[model samples]
Target: MTKKLFYNDAYQTSFDTQVVKNDKDEEGRDYVVLEETAFYPTGGGQPFDEGTLNEIRVDNVEEVDGEVRHYVAEPLDASTVNGVVDWARRFDHMQQHSGQHILSAIMQDEFGMATLSFHLGAEIVSIDLDATDLTEETLEKAEERVNEVIRDNRPIETKWMTVDESNQYPLRKKLAVDEAVRLVVIPDVDYNGCGGTHPRSTGEVQMIKLLGWSRQKKIVRLEFVCGNRVLEQLGNKHKVLNGIKGLMKRPEEALEQEVSSFIKESKQKDKQLAEQMAQLLEYEARDLASTAGEAAGVPVIERVYENRTIKTLQDLGKKIVEQTPSGIVVLVSEQKDQLQYVLAQGANCSGNMKEAAEKVMPLIEAKGGGKPNFVQGGGTKAIAADAFAERLREAALETVE
Candidate 1:
C-alpha cells in the first residue's frame, strides 16, 4: 500500500515523493502513482484532491486495488518529483467534513437521531438522518449545540487501532471494516470511524449552518454549509434580495406585501379580460351562422383564419354549430407553418362529421379522432388555406349525399 501522508498531516500542502509507476491506460490517459502522497483520493463521500504533480496538472485521483493513481494530462519525465495539494480545495473539504462530524454527533446526542448517510457537494453538504420529521425547534436546538462545540475549540484526534482495540472508545457508529480501523475522535463528544480527512480542531470548521431539511421517506436530509461557504451563501442571498427590492421599487420590509397585492390585481384583470373575450366570440359565432351557405339542403359554414389557435377554432366551431341546429361548421386556422382544422355538426344534422374530417385530414397528413358530430386535427400546410376549405366543404356535402 502507498504511504498515506494525508492521514498523518491534513495540513500538508506539498511533499516530495518518487513516482512508483508511470503509465498510460487503455484510453491513453497518463497516470502516475507516487510512493507517498499528501493527495487524498476520492472516497468516503469526500472528493479527491486536485493540484500539480511535477508541474503537470492532476485532474483526478483514485485508489484502485492498493495503489493511489494520480490521473494527469501529461506524463512526468522524472521519477523523483514534488507533489503539491490544492490547499484551498483540501481545506474546504476539511471544513465541511469536520463540520458534518460535529453536527451529526450533536444530533444523535441530543435527539437520538442517527446519521444514515453523508454527501459533500460543491456548494453544500448534507446528512441523511433516521427521523420521520424534523421540526424547526429541533433543528435550531441541534444547530445551537453544534456551534457551541465549535466555539469550545475542541481538539480532534485520529487513532489507528486493531479491530479489538477499537472497542475501547465510545464510537457513535459501528465500524464497517473488521480490521485496520481508524477512529476520528472529539473527546467526550464524538467518536466515529471515518476514512475522510478532517481538521485538527472543531474550531477549524469555522461555523456550521443548517440551511434546511427535506423529508425522504422516514428520513430527513439536512442541507448545510461550513466555513467560507457560509459567507458565500449569505452574499449571494443578499445580492438577490437587493435585486428584488430594486425591481419592485420598494424597501425590503414592504416587498412581500407589494408583490402579493400586484399578483391579486393582475389575476382580477385576467378574469375581466376572459369575460370580454367570451362575449366577443359569441357575437362572431352568430355572424358566421347567419352567413352560412346551403350544402345539400343543410347550412354549411367554411372559413380559414390566420395566426389563430386550435382552441379558438374549436370554440368557434362549437358555437356556430350550436347556433344553427341544421348546420355544419368547418373552421381552419393557419398557425406558424402548420394548418389546424375543426369540424362540428348541429344536433339536428344527419351527416357524419367524422367522415368529412377523415377525407380532408389525409390531404395534409393530419391525425385526430372524435364522435360522428365533432373532430379536430392539424398537419403541415401542404395545400393553400382556401383550397383546403373548399375540399372540406365538398367532403361534408358528400356525407350529406
Candidate 2:
C-alpha cells in the first residue's frame, strides 16, 4: 500500500518519494506509483489532487487495488523524485469537504435531516438530504449553525479505530467498512467515518453559503459554496450585474424594475408588428387574385416568392382563395435549399386540391397531406421556384377537367 502523506497533513504541498513502479496501461498512458505521496486520489465525493511529479505533469491520480497510481505525461528518469500537489486546489477541496461535514451535521441535529450523499464538483458542491423538502428558513438556520462552528474554530480530530471502537463516539452515520476505520471527529458534536483530507480546525473552512435547494428523487439536493469559492461566485455575479446595469443605463438599485419594464414593452411592440404584417399579406393576396389568369373557366393565381416562410405561403393561399371564389391558388417559395408550396381552391370551386398536390408532390419528391380543398408540402430545390409554381398551376387545371 502507498503511504498517504495527505492523511498525515492535509496542508502538505511538497514531498520526497521514490518511484517504486513505472508502467504503461493498455492505451499506452504512462503511470508511476510512488512509495509515498501527498497527492490525494479521488474518493468520498472529493476529487483527485493535480500537480507535478519530478517536473513531469501528473494528469490524473487514482487509487487502484490499494495503490495510488499517478498518471503522468512522462515517466521519471530517476527513482528518487519530488512530488508537488497543487496547493490552491488542495486547500479548496479541504474547505469544501470539511464544510460539508459541519453543514450535514447541523442539518441532522437541527432538522433531523440526514445527508444521503455528497458531490464535490468543479464549480460547486452539493449534498443530497433524506428530507423531502428544504425551505429557505431551514437553509438559513443550517447556515447559521455551520458558520457558528467555524467561528468558534472547533478542533477537527481524526482517529483510527476498529469498527467496534468507533461506536463509543456520537457518530452521525454508520461506518461502511468493517476494519481499519478512520473517524473524523468534531468534539462533542459530530463523528463520522471519512477518508478524505480536511483541515485541522473548522475555521479553515472560512464560511459555508447555501445557494439553493431542489427536490430530486424524493430527496432535497442542496447546492452550496465554501471558503474561497464563495468569494469567486460573488465576484462573478457582481460582474454580470454591472454589465446589465451599464447596458440598461440604470443604477444598480433600479436595474430589476427597468429590465422587467423593458421586456413588457418589447412584447407589446412585437404584437403590434405582427398585426401590421398580417394586414400587408392580405393586401398582397388581393392584388395577386385581381391579376389571376383564366384556366378551364376558373381563376388561377400562381406566384413564386424568394426566401418566404412556409407559413407565409399558407396564409397567402388562404387569402387568395377567399378573394376569388372560383380561384385556384398555387404559391411556391424558396427558403434556403428547399422549395415549399401551398395549393388551395376556393369553396365555390370543384377542383380536388389534394389530387393536384398528390400529382405534383411526387414530381418534386415532396411530402404533405390535406383535404380535398387545400394542401401544403415541401421538397428539394431541384427545379426553379417559378417552374415548380407553373407545374402546380397545370396540375390544378388538370384536376378541374
Clashes of each: 0, 0
Best by lDDT: 2
Off by over 4 Å in 2: 74-78, 278-401
Q: Candidate 2 lDDT, tens digit per residue, 1-401?
A: 78998888888999998888999877898999989999999999999999998889989999888888999988667788899999999999999999999998999988999999999999999999999997778888889989999999999998888999999888887777888899999986689999999999999999988999998989999999999999999999999999998899889999989999999999999999999989999999889988999987899888888888888888888999999988899888887888999999999998898998888887678988888899999998988889889888888888885
Candidate 1 lDDT, tens digit per residue, 271-371? 99988988898999999988988867889899989988888888888899999998888888887778888888899988888988898898899888788
lDDT for 126 (candidate 1): 97
Q: What is residue 269's positional error in candidate 1, in angstroms?
A: 3.9
Query: In angstroms, how far off is 181's CA in candidate 1?
Result: 1.1
In angstroms, what RMSD does candidate 1 have relative to the true structure?
4.3
Deviation from native of the Cα of residue 208 in model 2, angstroms? 1.7
Candidate 1: lDDT over CA atoms?
A: 0.90
TM-score of each: 0.78, 0.79
